[model samples]
Target: MYAAFRDTVSMREVFDSCSGVTDVVSWNTVLGGYVKCGDIGNARMMFEEMPQRNGVSWSAMVGAYAGSGELDVAREMLDEMPAVGRNIVTWNSMITGFARHGLLPLARKMFDEMPVRNLVSWNTMIRGYAVNGEMDGARKLFDVMPEKDVISWTCMISGYAQAGRYTETLELFREMQSESSARPNEVTMVSVLSACAHLTALEEGRWAHTYIDKHKMVLDNDFNLGAALVDMYAKCGKTDMAVKIFHSLDQKNVSAWNALITGLAVNGDVQDCIDVFEQMKRSGEKPNDVTFVGVLTACAHSGLVDEGRRCFQSMSSSNCGVQPEAKHYGCMVDMLGRAGLLEEAEELIRSMPMAPDVMILGALLGACRMHKRFDVAERVQSEIIGLNTRQAGCHVLISDVYAAAGKWGEALDARRVLQKCTIRKLPGSSSSMR
Candidate 1:
């Protein structure tokens, strides 16, 4: 009970003064209390002082070490635990710990050695593979599973979605539905809707939305699913429907608001985005860094330079309660550059707390192209090259800037550099309405 409340100090005091002699359960409880408080030293001390040790005691120590990222020690403890006493939970704990740390090979090896396997063991391995970008490995394991659950399917779908394999994500969603088992849940729907948003698969997105409605999946109750729906409709050129859904939500949170704001900004509904931002503020929803990203982006797109400046400045102000991150700074630089304020943009970049990234420099080059400022373009090009960044868009922008200024030799040189750079731009994706 004391452990549940997380009063480790008090729990310790009370345990030490208790009327009864200490038993293994009492010792384990105190160890757990220390672990909960993240006092690994005390937890270890208690573990060593315990009169007797059981699987629970050993598992607690292993988990404590694992939770603190001391995987080597956790493994040592695991090895020390009696082979007869190491249960599925203990093995799962170690596998989960290794997987969490991106030690997939070690995790897989342990997984192979486990005498018993359960759904969790299989799912953990699958998730670990998916997270480590070993989708082929995840697929291989997934195919051989004797029994599959919703989490297993969701993990694969989420993996594909995260890797930006949007088409495959939708295909898998359809496949899951066609299997007649493992019906898509709220989590699965969110992943599917995210893929639809990226692909702009309006028809498929609508079908998913229809599924949610037909299944009575409780959009009003599930903020994440509701937000994903708004995002999908907005990205699919159905901002009106997105707006309708947003207004209908009774329990909107910051994330839900951010989704709507970003969607509106991406759809080029600049005024609407700004208005919604203001509404968000008036509603007392604290705008986070993401919310400002959308606000600054909308301002940049619509050439609202003064508004962008104000928004950027507000990020540092106490009233706004958010700090400007790299993306936010990038948006601000882009806004200034687009308005033909190349000098101001460069000055802002120079004053940044951290080094300006290629995206920031590339925005300046884009501005140079519009205003035909070859000197500024040359400066930005040098900075971009110095970063050793192989962003193809940066090279392409430099070439365009030179070409627009009628510097054919420099343009050709830029193109040559682009050709020499090994990095390639990913192919752009688009989908049509059915």
Candidate 2:
């Protein structure tokens, strides 16, 4: 009971009181309690003082050492263990340690040498490969696994989603549905919803939502899953459905709020996006970088110059304390440029703590074209050239700005420079369903 509660102090006191009556099990229990509490030194002392040890005792020490990242000592302990004490648990501890520390080769070596492997052993290996961005390695192992659990499927799906292979993520989910009995859990649905949002596969997203409801996966209870659903609907241009899901959630975390705000902003519902941000603040959920991005985006879309400036100022440490990142600055620049405040936009770029990226400059150049600000456009073109950016849009914008001002020679010069730079614009494409 003491061990279960992690009451190491009480367990140690009781063990010392009944020293003569204590068995190996008692000692192992105390050792495990210390290990669980992360007191490796005390655990080691407990191990050394043990009158007799068993497989559990040895495995505990090996696992503790491996977990603490002392792999060398863990190996030494494993080597010293009698054949009877060196069990699968002990071997797995080493593999888990190596895999967690990004030592995939060593983990595979240990895995290949294990005399016998369990489901956990396979899952750990696959998870290691997936997390390390080696999806091919993970997939190869996942395909041959004797049996797959929910965790096994979730790891592969999550890996594909994280790696931006959204189409494959959805494909794997479909395969899992038909081929595996393990029902998709909250985690599985989160990854699936993310894939659907990226691909704008509204039908698949709606199907996943239905599956969640059928399985009694309460959206109100699971904030992450709720947020994903909100995000999926919002991305697919179903703002009303997204709003419905967002309101249905009883527990509104920062993520859920971000999804709603960003979704509304993307859909061009500027007032609703701003209102949601205000509601988020009133609810005492601190706005994160993402939340502000959405708020600024809405402001940009509608030319809310004064509101955007105020929001940008609030991001300082004295206010909401979300230090404005490049993206925030980009939104501000875009907002100001759209309002025909080119000088103020350029000033903000210059005031940035870090070097301005190409996107920020591109916004100013585009603004220059709209306002016929040929002088500022020329200055921005020089900066773009200095950065040696390969973004074809910026060069094209420079030529357009010159052409708009009736400066034909300058426009021709801009095109000649673009040709000399050997930049090729990528063809745009769209995805559709039959």
Candidate 3:
């Protein structure tokens, strides 16, 4: 739209043409256009110059700032508005702005201060809590709401999805249908499908498919929901079903492609994962960082070291700007380490642009355990444990190394510290696993 007028007409010229229109609707449309075109300066200018500002205008400007990732400015706009006759739209905009931006405390404050709370206001706060992993807060809000709708139910389902709480999502989704004005919508099904996918609840996922088909809601613009369905199936380790869905998708996006590729990778179907990547590129779907990670992880699991190395390198200087962070480095190192190429993995760590973190060291430690390299294991263990937010499980790793090498006294010494300090092992650590 901007391209149509950029050469002959200035934005101001086009915007001013609406001046004689004389309605909040016209002004709001112009404001939204400015935001969409990324002209924040002019948007703010037109907003401040408006003679009559309605709740829609205030909400539009607030949304513009929030949409552009300017939470502070949005909050300021909210604060400057007169507290009289402020409609639900204004309050909901402010709540949603802060919530989307991950400003939970501020969003909470806004919700508490709202004089006449409505469904949107409650829904926004609930969505915020869900996004932030404050499920209890969301639940608390859900239990206390004077009114609820399908969106509110969907919000709860999505919160459960965020926590990988598949069962809870299904439970609440059922309850939503049984009670309230909340009939499940496309968004609600998407949440349920995602949970189904994540948990490999194929039966459940299939059930959602039936529901969407029954409702005739599987239109092409619903691609966001479709992408999620593909992701869920893939992550549930169901590559064949995932591929079937991808084939059915009319306009397959990068996300849809990534989902299928990731599913193959996660399931140790390396050749198919590579095939999908090549296919996506040929079809002009640009791979994002996550796409690369999924492919690399596939290569790692299947011992395609060369492909893994190439993928990691490609993510960096190859125009992706992903620049191989610690997780990528860790994945590559783990691949090599699992292959018993400990020295090569160590060399990769040394050559890393960023310092290796606990994950990297832990990978090396696992490799040491595989090949019984106690001496190297001790050093790697210490390095990993030091990086722990708490004590981690380093002491146990060191003790295990000593035991592996038959150094009884040192092993005993390590255990003594555990008895003395009463350190509980971190759940995901090797020390706890062993």
- The reply for model 2, stretches above 4 Å from the true place, is 4-22, 317-319, 381-424, 427-434
What do the candidate models score in CA lDDT, each in turn?
A: 0.87, 0.90, 0.78
Please give, for residues 162-268, the per-residue lDDT of candidate 3 as tens digits: 78888899888878767766568877888888878767788878788788888888634554667777777787777777788888888888778887888888888
Highest lDDT, which number?
2
196-256 per-residue lDDT for model 2 (tens digits): 9999999999999999988889775553999999999999999999999999988999899
Q: Tell me which of candidates 1 and 3 scores higher on TM-score.
A: 1
What TM-score, to 2 decimals, does candidate 3 have?
0.82
List per-candidate RMSD values in Å: 3.6, 3.8, 4.1
Q: Predictions ranked by lDDT, top down?
A: 2, 1, 3
Model 2, residue pairs in steric clash: none
Angstrom error at residue 64, model 3: 5.2
TM-score for predicted model 1 compared with the true structure? 0.91
Number of the candidate with higher TM-score, 2 or 3: 2
Q: Model 1: how far is 363 from its true place, Å?
A: 1.4
**Candidate 1 positional error at 12, Å:** 2.5
